[model samples]
Target: MTQRQPRRAYDEQGREIPPPTLADLRAEGDRTAFVHCDATGCGHEATISTDQFPAEMPFPDIALPLRCAACGSKEVGVMRDVVGIYARPRERTGWGMT
Candidate 1:
């Protein structure tokens, strides 16, 4: 089997930085395994399939947390409430008014 290399975080200079180990990645994955929001202090919970992930993708072991790709913040959350039409009695028209 081929030896897997850890992913590195780089500075503005583009120099090589310390990479995350498989164990580290796994730990992170565990933390966010069920999370689906981008909130401060929130861990990443979703995972991408290895086949779909790029070979050089960082943090291979740890699933990528839901974040704002443009802003790189975990402050993003999935929209769960959706508006839909439903048939109701006229007397109940004001049920969802609030």
Candidate 2:
């Protein structure tokens, strides 16, 4: 069977956004993910949120054509938290000084 390719991510007005960077994350209010560039010695990494996308959006389904700022390579990978992290109140004893 053939695999289905994911559609490009769009903005509020339905305009296609490339690479889905920090700007897209802020607009969506989604949690964070690490974007890794696939260029040798490039080591470019970025944390971006996925708020605008559906909750069930797969990692492989993210918008492609991602380019590395360091090496100008077009290969990239996205990594997300396997477990969700929660916030705690300042008054909580578990956390020390603010």
* Best of the candidates, TM-score: 2
Best by lDDT: 2
lDDT of 1 by residue, 21-63 (tens): 4345444332122224345655443422333334343443334
Model 2: residues with Cα > 4 Å off, grouped in runs: 1-30, 52-56, 82-98
Global CA lDDT of candidate 1, please? 0.39
Give each model's whole-structure lDDT. 0.39, 0.57
For candidate 1, the per-residue lDDT at 33 reads: 22
After superposition on all C-alphas, the RMSD of every candidate to the true structure, in Å, is 16.9, 10.6
List, residue by residue over 23-94, the lDDT tens digit for candidate 2.
Answer: 544444437666788777888988655665565545445536456777888778766533222232435446
Model 1: lowest-lDDT 10 consecutive positions: 78-87
